[model samples]
Target: MPSTLRSSRDRPFLPKIKKSFTYHSTTNRGLTGMKSKGKMQGKALFYWSILLPALIVMLWLTLYPMITVFLTSFQNYNYISGRRSWIGLGNYKNILADQVFLTSFKNTIVYCFSTTFLEVLLGTVLALVFYGNFRGKSVFTILLILPMMLSTMVVSSVWKTLFHYDIGLLNTILSRIGLVRVGWLIDPHIALWSIVLVDVWQWTPFAFIVMQAGLLSIPQEVFEASVVDGASYQQRLLRITLPILKDQILLLCLLRTIDTFKVFAKVFALTGGGPGNATETTSLFVYREAFQYFNLGRSSAASMITLAAVVLMSIFYLRKMLNSKEA
Candidate 1:
C-alpha cells in the first residue's frame, strides 16, 4: 500500500518536468530564429551604407542637370539678362520654325547614319580579311588604330590642313595625277562629305577592333563543323557569321550613332559650321545658342530634342540586345 502511494506521487512530478522541458526548447528555437533574422538585417544595412554615397552622387550629377534642363526648356531664359519667363512650349515652337535648327537637325541625321553605316561596314570587312594570323599583322593593326588614339581636336586640325584648297597634300596629289583640285571644305556641296571622310578615317579602326574581338570570341570548332558540312565561305558568312555578329553590330551602331550625332569638335575645327551651314549639327547649334547668343531657352529646347532622339535609339538598341541575349 505504501509503495503504490509513492508511485502515484512520482507520476505527477514527471508530467511537470516534461512540460518544463518543452517550454525551454520552444524558447531556444525562437531566440535562434530572431538572431538569424537580425544578422540578415544588419548585413543588408551594411550593403546599403556602402552603396548610398555613389547613388546620391550619380543622382546629383546626372538627374539634377536633366531636371534643370527640362524646366529651362519651357521657359524663355537668358543667362546674361538673368531673366526667366515660363513660355510653355514657345521655345520649342520657335526652335522648330528656325531654319538653322532644321538644317542642323538634317545634317546631324545624315552624319549619324552615314558614319555609322560606313564605319561598321568597313570594320567588318577589315576584321574578316585579317582574321587569320599572318606576318606583320600586329604592326599593321597598331598602325591602323593609331588614328583613333589621337585626340579629336588634333585629328581635325590635321585634316583641316589637308583639306586646304591650295598647297594641301590631297590637292597636291590630284595635281600630280593630272586631276583638277577639288574644294574639299570650301564648297557647300562637298564640305559635309569631307567631314564624313575625316570621321570614317578616325573611327573605322575602333569598329574594326570591336568586330575583331567578337570574331575572336567565336569558337573555331563551329566554323570547322560548318566546313565539314560542306559550307562555302559565302555560305558560312551568311548563315553563321552574320547571325552571330548581329548583337555586336547593333551595339556598334548604337555607339557610333550617339557619337556622330553630337559632332562638334570636328565641325568646329575643320569648317566652323561654315561653307553655308552645310555641316552644322545639333550640338553646334546648341552651343551657339547657349554660349554665343546667350539664348538658354532655345539651347535647352534643342538639347531636349536631341536627348529624346538619343534615348529612343538607345532604348531600341538596348531592347534588341537584351532580347538577343535572352534568346
Candidate 2:
C-alpha cells in the first residue's frame, strides 16, 4: 500500500521535469535562430558599405551630368555670359529648323552606316581567310593590328600627308599609272568618304579580333562532322558557321555603329567638318555649339537628339540579339 502511493507521487514530478526540459530547448533554439539572423544582417550591411562608394561615384559622374544636361537643354544658358533663361523646348525647335543640324545628322548617318558595313565586311573576310594556322601567323596578326594601336591624331597626320594633292604618295602612284590625281580631302564629295576610309583602316582590326574570337569558340567537332559528311566550304559556312556566328556579327555591328556614329576626332583633325560641312558629324556639331559658340542650350539639345538615336539603334540590335539567343 505504501509502495503504490510513492509511485503515484513520482509520476506527477516526472511530468514537471519533462516540461522544464522542453521549455529550455525551445528557448535555446530561438536564441540560436536570432543570432544567425543577426549575422546575416551584419554581412549584408558590410557588403553594402563596400558597394556604396562606387555607387555614389557612378551616380556623380554619369547620372549627375545627364541630369544637368537634360535640365540645361530646356533653358537658354550661355556659358560665357552666365545667362540663364527657361525656353521650354525652344532649343529643340530651333535645332530642328536649322539646316546645319540637318546636314550634320545626314552626314553622321552616312558615315556611320558606310564605315560599319565596310569594316564588318572586311573584318569578317580577314577572319575567314586567316582562320587556320599558317607560317608567321602571329607576326602577321601583330602587324595587321598596328594601325589600330596608333593614335587618331597620328593616323590623321600620316593620312593628311598622303592626301596632299600635289605631293601625296597616293597621287604620285596614280600619276605613274596614268590616272588622275584625285582630291581625297579637297573635293567636298570625296572628303566624307576619305574620312570613312581612315576609320575603316584603323578600326577594322577590332572587328577582326571579335570575329576571330567568335570563330575560335565554335566547336571543332562541328566542323569535322561537316567535313566527314562531304560538306563543301560554302555549304559549311552558310549552313553551320554563319548560323552560329549571327550573334557575334550583330554585336560587331552594334559596337561599330555606335562608335562610327559619334565620329569626331578624325573629322576634326583631317577636315574640321569641311571641305564645307561635308563631314560634319553630330558630335562635331555639338562640340562647336557648346565650346566655340558657347551655346550650351543648343548643344545639350543636340546631344539629347544624338543620344536618342543611339538608344534606338542599341534597342534594335539588342532585340535582334536577344531573339536570336532565344531562338
Candidate 3:
C-alpha cells in the first residue's frame, strides 16, 4: 500500500533474452523431401545392381555371338587367310540360285512333313491302344519305347545294317519267305522312304508318350458323363478326348516338325545326304558349307533362313494355342 509501483524483485522477475530464435517450417519440409529422395534413389540403385550383372552376362554370351554372326554374314571370310571383304547379299543370292540348295530344300520339307505326319498318326493310334488297362502293360510299354531310348546314331547304324541290300536281315527274311529281296537304301527312289521308316520307328514312341500324357490329364468324370449319355467310344474320343488334347497335339506337331527339319545325324550315318541328294537336308547343307567349304557367310545365312521358317511355324502353333485358351 506504500506505493502502487512495486520493485522488480518484489514482482515476478522476467529476464529479457538477446538471442534470436527462428521457427522455419519450410526448412523441416525441405529435410523431409531430401530424406524421401534419398530413399527413392537407394531403391533405384539396388534394382540396377541386381539386374546389371545378368544383362552383362547375356550380352557377353548370347548377344555377342549373334552380333558376330550377323557381321560375319556380310563378309567373305576365309578362315585360313583371315581375310575379310564385304560381300553383302552375295551369299544369299548364291544359295538361292544353287540347285543343290533347292533340291535339299525340297527334300527337307518332304522328309519333315512325312515323318511328322506319320509319327503323329501312329502315335495317336498307339496311345489309344495302350490307354486302357491290360495284362503286362508296363512290359509292353517299356519294350515299345526302347527304340526311342536308343541314340539316333545307334538306331541309324542298326537300321543301316537291317536295310542293307546284299546281306541284311530284312533281305534274309524276305528270302526265307520266298519273296523277292528289295533294295532298301541303295535305291534312290526308295532310300529316302527307307530312312523315313527308321525315323518313324524311333520317334513314334515319343509321340505316343506325349499323347498318353495328354490322355491321362483328362478327367474320368467327363468319360463317365459321356457314358451316361450313351455316347459311343468313337463318339466320346472324337468329341471329348481330341478336343481337350488339341494343345498337346499341336505342341507335338511343332516339336516333331522342328526336329525332323533339322535331321542330320541319321542322314549322315545312313545315307550321307544321299545316294543322290535325294535325302539331303538343309542342316547337312549348312554343315557342309560351314565346315567342309569354310563358307561361314553362306552357312549363317542358311541357318538364319531355317530359323525364320521354324519361328514362323512356332508362331502358328502358339496362335492356335492362345485362341483355344480364349475359347
lDDT, each prediction: 0.86, 0.86, 0.81
* Deviation from native of the Cα of residue 324 in model 1, angstroms: 7.5
Candidate 3 lDDT over 71-172, as tens digits, reads 777778777677889999887788889888888888889999999999999998899887856677767777888999999999999998999888899999
lDDT of 2 by residue, 109-151 (tens): 9999999999999999998998867777777778888999999
Clashing pairs in 3: none
The lDDT of model 1 is 0.86
TM-score of 2: 0.85
Model 1 lDDT, residue 290, Cα? 97
RMSD of each: 19.2, 19.0, 23.2
Give me candidate 3's TM-score against the actual structure.
0.79
Judge candidate 2 at residue 317 and give its lDDT. Answer: 62
Q: C-alpha displacement of 269 in model 3, angstroms?
A: 0.8
Put down candidate 1 lDDT per residue, 1-327, tens digits, no spaces.
223323433444223322442345444345445658777677668778999999999999999999999999999999999999999999999999999999999998998999999999999999999886777777888889999999999999899889899978999999999999999999988999999999999999999988877777676799999999999999999999989877778878888988898899999999989888888899999999999999999999999998998888789856654554444
